[model samples]
Target: MRIPTVLLLACIPATAFAQQAQPETGSEWEVSSGVEYESGDYGTGTGTDIEILSVPSRLGMTIGRVQMIAAIPYHRIEGPSDVIPGNVLGLPLLPQPQPEADSVTRNGWGDLELGATYALPVKAVNFSLSGSIKLPTAENDLGTGETDYTIGAEVSKAISDKIIPFASFSYTLPGSPEGISLQDRYAVTGGMATWLGRKTQLSASYRYGENPDAAVTDDQRVQLGLNQWVGSGLSIGVYGSAGLSKGAPDQSVGLRIGFALD
Candidate 1:
């Protein structure tokens, strides 16, 4: 499948989300939002797919260490269609994900995710557990939506005074006829953050999740980035991701900017 930015991010969070977890839920009203654009080839052979571009924004809050998260993503894809010319085209030509056809082209919002998490105290480090629901908000006809929602949990552990390692897992329900045949969504991640000098902070991590399909599949991903404090409650960073699995994309890249407010 070939498409635009936002629409791609709107697909299954498990399939297109970052290697590290997106803290979308909590209690203290910790609001964070940003835009991202990426492109990748999803599979290989006749099944090889692609999402030309995708952009997604997110916001979340933390109350005494518990957080709630919510986000919306949009995407545009181009590939094959359901016609002869479409046969020449492929996935992104028909405007939607179809049963069997000559080609399919699509562009739209993928899915909505709403979830909550709690941080457990452990020495100088913080451990968190969370659960979320993946709302059916995309053009299932295109790529994502067959599932109604999902449930998830994550853990954060500190390795050193400034470095941390974390892991997570989640489950996705099946979809209706309007969405992708999302089987289950889950991932495990290890991450770290270090103070390079003063206002400069770097974060990096690796992630793995099951492919959202009717069959059993898995995906591996790596992420790296930096965070710098600009002023009072403003900061920015650049990030990128790469996929290492047969069930997932071959390559992906993007960036993010964030602002913290009270």
Candidate 2:
């Protein structure tokens, strides 16, 4: 399955919102769309670099403490056919080795993802439980043509007015494709965010996870982001990541713009 890199960018603004005061007792709607581009060899010795351009859009609604979300992405991929796009926020699962060929490019819609999350705040700490499912909505090769499920938990605490620390863990159960057995995946992330002012926030995080194929090294990465809020409901952010192991992307950068609907 291919994961859109915009998901990483969207988190920055959400983190900023989470650090703010409690929400009003009502229903709220949010919509976000962004384009992300990334290039990396993914540690493939073939020396062929895969470039991915994704235009992802998401819609979400919150009622009480529960939030529901849906996302669909369009992707244009350029590289060797043997190299598949990996999960941007977690480990990259390697595909079965095939005969080497000239560089090829493919572009089309990616898989659809639907999810729900519930959040609770007790005193100073906030906690959340989330789950998502990936639908096989893309054409052959753009997706696995199989379904996948993920469950996660996250916690964050504000130690000061300007600083907030957070941690998250997730487990993914991926469907195996024809003639291949994919292992379950899990990841852990720890990070902190600091406010530079009332509307500007900076964040940094580290992630570690297992690759679907046990033969490869584990995934490790460090990510940084900066977000600025415009007016009351618009947010803009820039994010970057550096890979620490062979199972991760060498480098990535993305931008996101989000708007909250009243």
Candidate 3:
């Protein structure tokens, strides 16, 4: 459900199966770690600049047609308390609004995210169904202090040897915390990935989503990514994003490395 980010990179390979035979029946494990940084005003009229630095680690397992992932991220946030990381929602009910010139900084582990996706048994194209949950295991004041859930569908096709196009749709139900009312969120993403060679890939994508609060504007963004497989089931990647709406961060960048084993 990570709309034009790491999730998109993960989907590209899944969709590539459209041009080949079914995946072999076996279990594979992967571990990934990355650092992501974002900066933006996030439509906060108070001119409070928000900055977030995150270091995330993920463990994944693929068995037959299903994939499961678990993620934990450490976050350092500096900005107004009303603005939270991850989804970039602006809440008016958060207590203690600092002066425009003053900002508070907090660093701790954020919520734990668990997800699973199943590939449908079809050959015409690659299709999948996925679900994820956000557990309220964050440190105090580091998260919404409530659990969240998301369900989604994705489709993709490998029309040529080098080009793959994909799309995803998702809906999220956020938990309401004390003194705050959150609305449902919906998101859609479309993108294409091109293989430059056996070991290199380039991708571009766009995403649009609704904010969890009706009073806030929607979110829109464009992203570009590059991935390179060095060898022996090890890979590295980098990505950058530009937000087109006030509800999102102005800019963000990330770098990730992953290794897989059968």
Q: Choose the strongest candidate by lDDT.
A: 3
lDDT tens digits, residues 72-185, model 3? 889888887554566322222233335474678888898888988788988788888888898888884777888889888888888788888888888888888886667888
Considering only N, C-alpha and C atoms within 3 Å, which residue pairs clash in candidate 2?
none
Compute the lDDT of residue 203 as modeled in candidate 2: 91
Alpha-carbon deviation at 118 in model 3, angstroms:
0.4
The residue ranges of model 1 lying beyond 4 angstroms of the native Cα positions read: 1-33, 47-49, 81-105, 139-147, 176-182, 214-217
lDDT of 1 by residue, 23-46 (tens): 333423333345444443334234
**What's the lDDT for all of these models?**
0.47, 0.70, 0.72
Q: Write the per-residue lDDT of candidate 2 for residues 1-262, one digit (tens) a residue.
A: 1111123335532332454535557877777787777776666555666778888888887676677888887878887764445432243333754334467888888788898877775556677788889887875377766788989887888888889888888898988777556788898888988889877778998988887776666778898988777765677878888889876778878787877776
RMSD in order of candidates: 8.4, 4.3, 3.8
Q: Each prediction's TM-score against the native?
A: 0.70, 0.89, 0.89
True-vs-predicted CA distance for residue 124, candidate 2, Å? 3.8
| Global CA lDDT computed for model 3 | 0.72
Give lDDT for model 1: 0.47
What TM-score does prediction 1 earn? Answer: 0.70
Rate residue 164 of model 1 by lDDT.
48
Residue runs of model 3 more than 4 Å from their true location after superposition: 1-21, 87-101
**Clash pairs, model 3 backbone:** none
